[model samples]
Target: MGLKIYNTLKREKEDFIPQNPPYVGMYVCGPTVYGNSHLGHARSYTSFDVIYRYLKYCGYKVRYVQNITDVGHLVGDADEGEDKISRQAALEKQEPVEIAYKYELSYFEDMRKLNILPPDISCRATGHIIEIISHVQALIEKGYAYVTDKGNVYFEVKKFASYGKLSGRNLDDTKSGERIDIATDKKAPEDFALWKSADGGHLMKWPSPWGDGYPGWHIECSVMSRKYIGDTLDIHGGGMDNIFPHHECEIAQSEALTEKPFVRYFIHNNMLTVNGSKMGKSLGNFIVLKDLFKKMNPMVLRFYILQSHYRSVLDFSDESMTAAGVGFERLRNSIFALKDVKIAENDDLTAYPELDALKKEFLDAMNDDFNTPIAISVLYEILKHSNNELNKADRDTAKLEAVKRMIFTFTEDILGFNWNMADNTDSGEENNREDKLIEFLIEIRKQYRTEKNFAMSDKIRDTLKDIGITLKDAPQGTTYTIS
Candidate 1:
């Protein structure tokens, strides 16, 4: 079967055929870079990373573009309030760009730890001010945008009849539910800003056509995506929280100017929740990626996310992470066992029908809108069968190797798991020796603990820590991880 994707634009799972064959252009909404990246950021990026990987695996030359909002993301999701970076800069007593660059680097570092591939183009809003100004000019010339006396420009949402099509709310209803703020001088309450007038106090103002101001939050993605990729995107992805107002305004302005579809496939990942509320900085319940990494393996967190469908809301808790860690260990152990099986010259033709069946099931699950949960189950099935075969009196070494290759293809290749990088890089014999020595030391430490020699056990841990090995004591037992 061909690939199918859940397009938020169409509101259904549709077959994914690229606008240009052998090439796909994807643009995902990136972070604001005003603060540290949290779990919500991880879910959105990881979800799109899988899509980018899968597209490339299917032979589409994918050019993925994710932008950084260094400026112009206002507070309260409105045309008012200080820019997020400006707000953070005032708190830190630093320049707005300084805060943006700091968090931007930190965000990339955390993403690298999670094994997410970098985008082909990491556009920044501030860097694209010229293009954004030109885009606003085109919108105004097309009569889709208008400027107020204060030099602030707003998109004419009434001029675009399909303003609320993406969010499924008509102008009448949107206006009825809209909360008018005294800060905006928009012609309509539902209309959004294209450009904002900045005062002397604003730290991040640029020379735009509308005076010293910055692009609006929604305009940056529309302008930057077109400048980097194209006017019509093959895939545009973000969290579901961005559907209304943000993406809604993007569609209004982009389509109003181009008179074409802004995005063909609109993919949205559901939010990650903690204690039944969204895990976000606004809620003060967010877990930063760097802090989470110090507690557990980053791949463990990735595996926990893969356990649920991207469209489904995932609840975060320590218990869920522990379960995911256990599952990840099981997967790694199975792959390790397969690789350990010795191979001799084999003339015997082993019929491993299970291997082919497992591949089919895995692909089928993935092709159905990237169903990673079901696909991961197929990995366990392959592992279970491989373990049973390896334990037999006459093991088919060729079959074992084939199973290992399949596991690598699914985990490392498609799922973006850096298994080999995370595992020992030494040769087989050297790794075996190191493993045995570590196990021996751990066993001796256990013996010391059993004898109530707390000082000796502590000494063992402290000595290992000094040598770049950190030991964590948990209910399961004490385990050492090499730093």
Candidate 2:
């Protein structure tokens, strides 16, 4: 089956077609880099990473561009607050540039831990000020934007006939939904800022055509996406949270200036919540990846995120994470166990009907809108059959080798797991130390199981799995393998 993706703009799954065949230009809204990267950041990036990976796997030479919002990202959606990085700088008593660079490094570090591929061009908003000014000027010339007496520039929502086309909210609906006070300088309450006039003491101001000001949040994406990719992008992706105002504004200003569609397929990943509630620092449920990495492997978190479809809401909890850890360990252990199997030196899958069916199922799942959960289920099924085959006294080395190749292709290539980190068999001393550590953990788990404290026992098992140790509970006793 051909690949299909759910285009948010179309509001349906559409056939994957690039404007330029065999070449895809993809853009994803990146972090504002005002703080540490959190679980929300992980979910969004990982979702797009799979898209980027799968497109390449399907023979598309993809140029993925992700922007770092280092400036002009106001804290308020109404575009009426201090810049996010500037606010963070004030809180930390540092320069705004310092805050942006520190957190930009943090964001990339966390993304690397999750095995997310870096974008082809990582553009920062500060670096693209010249381009942003040029784009805003074009919008003004086209009568889609207006410069106010206050030196602020706003996109004239009413002037753009299809302002709400992407968001499905008309001007009336947008005006009624304003929780934050609308900026009085705007021609209409719904009109958004293209550039905001910076105050005299503002730390991140640039000399634009409209006096000394900075580019607004929406303009940066529209500007940078066009500068790197083109007026039209094959795939534009972000969290669903970006759909309404941020993405909607991007469509308005971009189409207004270029007179072309902003994106072919607008893909949005669903938001992640913690224990059924929205994750937030105010609620004390915010999960920063660097802090979470202290407790578990980042790959386990990636596996957990992939367990649910990207369009489905992912509820985060310690319990759910532990469950995913166990499943991840089982999957990795099964795949890693075949590392020593000798191949038949013949790459023929026709004889292995079961492996062939499993391969088709895996590809079918991935092709069906990158359905990772279903794809992961196929991995489990492959491992189950492989385990049954291994139990036999005479195993087919060729069949086992074929299974290994299929599993590796899916898990390592498409799913983006670091098998080397999971199955690191270093030298003698390190291996000896890891072996003893596994034995120690196993013994503790056994005691907890004896005491009927299944929760504690399960915790021990899951914790060990998070660190690349897989324990097997057999009828005789519990034995462990270092993944």
Candidate 3:
């Protein structure tokens, strides 16, 4: 079966076919860049990173565009609140651009640590003001938007018959769901802003036909994605929270202007929760990525996320993270164990059905909606088989080589685990031998101490202490740690 993705637009799994064969254009909504990224941001970006990697693995030339929302993301919906960057700038007593730049750099740094590939084009919202204004002008000319007396341009949601198709919300229901005051400038309660006029000397405002104003939150994505990718995107993705107003409004404005489908497939990853509660800064329950990295390896965090299906809700807890670290170490250690195997000169015509089955299972799992959890299970199965083969008294050297290549292909090449332990030529093998020898001597020392041979134990401890390794004794037991 070909790749099957669960499209939020159809609310079902659909076969993925790019608009142009072998060339896929995917746009995922990126961070607003007003503050440090949180775990939720990690989940969304890492999920798409896998998608991007797998697409290339399947021989598709994919151009992934993730926008940086440096401006135009308001505090509240319907464009009646201050921009997020503006609020952060006010509190920090700096320009909004300064805040955006600071957090944008931090975001990429965190993503790089997590092994998330940078997008092909990261278009900033503020950098595309001219394109956004032109987009709004096209909407106005098509009779789908109106300019208010205050120089605010609002998209007439009622004018677009299919405004709620992507979100599956009708106009009446959307209007009734609004519990806050509606902007008087909007033509209707469901109408959203295409542009909002600056009340005073707004720091992020730009010159548009409507006056000194800025593009609306939803308009920013529509303009940037279309300009960077195309009028029609092969895939549009983000967290599920953007389903209703943010993505819905993007579809309405873009389709109304082009009279064509804006996105072929819409992918939304589920949110991350902490202790069964949704993670958000407003909730005071979010864990910043940088702070979390202090206590955890970034790859362990990525492994924890991929343990569950992308569409499934993942909960964060100390126990879960610890278990993930252990599991990730096991996975990595299994790969490292195979690095010492020497390839036999004779090619193995030996048909290993187990190896073939493992590869098939992995491909099947990934083909079914990029089910990474199942794919990881297959990795463990392959590792288990490799361990059993390695422990045999007489091993087939050629079979071992095949297993080694298979593990490398699945884990490092396909799954994005760098696992460069084999690449460190001088230290990698030497350290392995040293670690084993140290553990052996430590075990011998333990036996001596158990029999009350204090002199031998002390001699062993002092000899090791002369080197870099240090021995620590605790309530559990005596263990050796590298200094």
The number of the candidate with the highest TM-score is 2
lDDT of 2 by residue, 328-443 (tens): 88987898788887866664655888788988999999999999999999999998877877889988777787788888889988999888756532223454566777888788
Candidate lDDT scores, in order, read 0.85, 0.88, 0.87
**Residue-level lDDT tens digits of model 3 in 1-483:** 899999998999999999998999999999999999989999999899999999998999999999999887888654787788999999999999999999999999899878789999998988989989999999999999999999999999899999889888898899895637688777788888888898755688887877899888899899988887889999999999899899999999999998889999999999889988987778888799877766566777888999999999999998888888778888877778888999767668356888998899998898899999999999999888778878899887777788888888777667776666323323324556787898898889989999999999999999999987898887877788776
RMSD of each: 8.7, 11.0, 10.9
In candidate 1, position 464 carries an lDDT of 84
Q: Which ranking of candidates, highest lDDT first?
A: 2, 3, 1
Residue-level lDDT of model 1, residues 83-143, one tens digit each, is: 8899999999999999999999999988987899999999899888888899899999999
Q: Of models 1 and 2, which has the larger TM-score?
A: 2
The pairs that clash in candidate 2 are none
Task: List the candidates' TM-scores in order.
Answer: 0.86, 0.87, 0.86
